[model samples]
Target: MHKVIIKYVLIGVLAATALTSPVRAEAVVPLTVQQFFEVCQPTRVTDFVDDNDYIQFGLCMGVIVGLSSLMDLNCQLDRNDTPNHLKADLSGGNTSLTAYRQTMWNYSNDNPSLRSFPVGMLAASLAEEWPCIEPL
Candidate 1:
């Protein structure tokens, strides 16, 4: 049927466009600071945003919340040296998901040079805020 043929063609074009898009291509890996910031940070004022921004904001919150939840689960990277271990501490904090997203965005904005490294960027911001207690 012509309709079926058109549907397949449309799907193919969409797939090809996603594959060829630089942003989508790089998204296969963990989002780096630059990537995270670009996706998460709204370029326009809230009132001026188009419907597309809802998708962007939703995606941004999802990533931020996922990362925060991992931290809450006490994600740890232990180095041989006790003091070098990384962990999160969300005790007694009233911080919301939006706060976490903003904090991360700020960190990314402040450190453009570290944009390529996701974990490192996380370590510098989230981990540093509430690091693990070193054992004696």
Candidate 2:
């Protein structure tokens, strides 16, 4: 009975550790400049024209840009720079829109003056005018 109990306890401990272990998964689609523009354009415009949506949209875009930049740097996806482990902390981390938004909120908090209205308008304009020459 003692040996059986010990085996069960060991099994439980191992199972718990396995469950808690972090897993890293590759990004589903590499974020392209074209996709970035496509996602940002409408959101920016809607925020600009509508006072109600401006703040939310602006903050959202800021976060998206921020995350993309970070991912690009970490993954060495940028054309100019060599890839590095700048995002070592985020290793085995989950990637999703909610995570991006949270990161944006943190960024906004650090820079309080970066309000939604202006940022949103600017992002909208950039998205609208900029042509993504890069092939996805």
Candidate 3:
């Protein structure tokens, strides 16, 4: 009696869930590696800052570096410098995160294939833009 009722209720619940699950399954569109990069790439300078004008480039760089690092994409930084460390070095009275973001954005446009690991491209760009000068 009671057992029979509970068994039917469970079956009904299972059937209902099975019918609804396909809707969620269909909503998730799978993205390829290139597509993922295209979607994640920075579009504008404001993407790296807020109303306060404080640097948010670290966060954007973190997501780019973090995902690539986890994927083992070989996006190593020069001397293994972290994003915050790099941003700190780049920061100055005139230079801003916006400039850094724009530089990265331009690099991304010129070389779309490197999107999987942009930090490598960024390191190269930084090296070009500001070569080290040793004092004699």
Candidate 4:
């Protein structure tokens, strides 16, 4: 009975700490540009391609889209430059995630470079084509 009480107390403490942990809205490290490249190596990409690892590919795409959304929230994306169609699609439904994933894969494949990070590159491509007249 004592052990059971201690276990419940410990769980409650952990839950409280987790809930109260400081989570900044913006990260100190720029994930899209640097972390993406570090994590998504050419070899990994190749492995996914060769294996047709849809699961892994989907996970990576999800992360990229998430990062892109964060960038958008941080006023990094050019909303003004984004086409109405793209914006509409992105805001419309879950299908937009697929669209972004396709774009990321094609962009990453065509523009392979040591300096290029797939997520950052994709974000830049979108910005360049549909740059906001001013930062949001």
lDDT of 4 by residue, 91-120 (tens): 323545555555554555566672444345
Candidates 2 and 4 compared by TM-score, better number? 4
| Model 4 clashes, total count | 3
Query: Per-prediction count of colliding residue pairs?
Result: 0, 0, 0, 3
Model 4 C-alpha RMSD vs. true structure (Å) is: 9.6
Which ten residues in a row are the worst by lDDT in model 1?
A: 77-86
- lDDT ranking, high to low: 1, 4, 3, 2
Task: Write the candidate numbers in order of decreasing TM-score.
Answer: 1, 4, 3, 2
lDDT, candidates in the order shown: 0.63, 0.41, 0.44, 0.48
What stretches of model 3 exceed 4 Å from their correct place? 1-58, 61-93
Candidate 1: residue pairs that collide: none
- Using TM-score as the yardstick, the better of models 2 and 3 is 3
Taking the tens digit of each residue's C-alpha lDDT, what string does model 2 give over 37-59? 32333333533544334444554
lDDT by residue (tens digit), candidate 3, 1-136? 9999999999999988966765433332113333323433555655534422222333455544543333222223233443432322232236544455455556566777776653444544443443332223
Residue 78 accuracy (lDDT) in model 1: 38
Instruction: Estimate the overall C-alpha local distance difference test score of candidate 3.
Output: 0.44
Error of 4 at 10 (Å): 15
